[model samples]
Target: MIQPFIRVDGPAAALPEENVDTDIIYPARFLLITARLGLGPYAFHDRRFRADGTEVAEFVLNRPEWREAPILVAGANFGSGSSREQAVWALLGRGIRCVIAPSFGEIFQANCYRNGVLPITLPPAQVAALSAAAAAAHPFAVDLEAGTVTVAGRPPIPFSVDLERRLALLNGWDETATLLNAYGADIGTFEERHRRHQPWLFEGENDA
Candidate 1:
């Protein structure tokens, strides 16, 4: 679960490219694991490390200052491939509480919610400006409640998330929990009706 709202403070860097798929975020080889173990070290597998197992200094995440980036300022259409929930888990596991991009893959955004990561959307220009500002200052702030991002002591810029998604993140509710809450009364009614129509299925009512 995530706190309703918290300010994110960390160095920010830009991916500055679109269609960043799950494999790039968490490689396919790392998949097939039940527990989210040892995944953080490999997050951004291709971009952060080379095939021979050496760091790619050019990648933003490979830098020492940006490794624990609490707020990720990225390009448009981030998280654009397979709907692997592990990607979200890997990100949250790595201490990245929030992602600020112009847009996100539909399924990937939902996955973020399930794993307690908040993905925010902003204008393309705004993302570029924030990325630049973050480079100047090691730590920046992303206020989930205020829906604002402040970098380099600049004025806050507003961002938005889907209303339903925002509500889920705020309450730390996943899809199953949300559905159960929405259908609580209906489920009770159905159970009562089932007992009446099929008394044999009810433990107490079926006694001979």
Candidate 2:
């Protein structure tokens, strides 16, 4: 079962560039690995470090204070590119629980929710404000239940998520589990009807 996501409170890191594709989030080379574990160290590998194995000092994630920040405030069209689920896995592996942006790539946004990560879309101005606030070491609290993002000295910013996705996240149910929970009785009834209407289908099983 997926873990429920209700709220997250922590310092935020900023990636202000637009159209950060999946390759940048988790490079293609790392896609060979099937396991999600240990992908954290490879998240933003090229941007976070250089060929000599030295950390890039200018990258926000490389900053001493923001290294472990759990929230990310980014620019518009974040997660653009191929639909690589590993991108979300990489972020989660690195302890990022929430990403606030003006917009996100279609598949990437869905993948975020499926993986128990909150991807909040807000007005461009509001996203920029959050990015600035994070740069100054301000902490952010995101409440999925309330649909609000709160930073000190600013009014709470409201956002939207699909109702079904919100419920799934709140209940820790993946797609298959959500479907079963919602239509268990109907499924059972259908099964019984099939058994009665298609007894021949099950005849060979009894003989075996």
Candidate 3:
């Protein structure tokens, strides 16, 4: 996942109320071990598409206007359910940059960060206003640096993110990235010392 703090380049729209889970975002059948190819099409499997395998035209994502949505303005406790990183991957693959809601599931929120998606939380009024703007417009932009979400004529609405996650997303970092940076030199030194102390660990120069 690439961690670049970008201006969210489209309108933000709140999802329908409540309990939007991982399975809704990405179904279990698609969770096979295959690499992430083609997951974007199945992004919101059962919601955007019907049980008969047809498009649900009335769904927010099914609407042509929302095809390029970059920020999701969702209700409280969004992304709740089984811990599946694939849900976050699907959202990212489909070009969603950030999600705004009153709250998010802890696991889902962590997955979002790991996958390089920014999750923003705002009050209920702000969420409603943003969703309304998205319904009325095409592309709204959220400037991460400025901490503002701007639509055509509305006041630039402010938003907030957790400090640690914000820094990680802005820098395109996950736990591994943080660890590597923090301990790279020390780890390298330790490896060298270990090799010297335990000669039997290496059988020959070929092993080195």
Best model number under TM-score:
2
| Regions of candidate 3 where Cα sits further than 4 Å from its true position | 1-3, 183-208
For each candidate, what is the lDDT? 0.78, 0.90, 0.79
**TM-score for each prediction?**
0.82, 0.86, 0.82
TM-score of predicted structure 3: 0.82
> Considering summed lDDT, which 10 consecutive residues are worst modelled in model 3?
5-14
For candidate 2, write residues 1-208 as lDDT tens digits.
4778999888899999999989999999999999966789989999999999999998999998789999999998999998999999999989998999999998999999998999999999999989999999998899999999999767888999999889888877789776788899999899779989998876767553
Compared with the true structure, what per-residue lDDT tens digits does model 1 show for residues 88-160? 8888778888888889998998777777788888888888877777665446888777888777557888887
lDDT of 3 by residue, 53-144 (tens): 98988888777778777788888888898898888888988888788887898899988887778888788887787777777764677887
Better of 1 and 3 by lDDT: 3
Better of 1 and 2 by TM-score: 2
- Judge candidate 3 against the unseen true structure and give its global Cα lDDT, from 0 to 1: 0.79
Query: What's model 1's TM-score?
Result: 0.82
Per-residue lDDT, model 1, residue 70, is 76
Deviation in angstroms for 135 in model 3?
Answer: 1.8
Candidate with top lDDT is 2
Give the winner by lDDT: 1 or 2.
2
Backbone clashes in model 3: 4
Model 2 spans with C-alpha error above 4 angstroms? 183-208
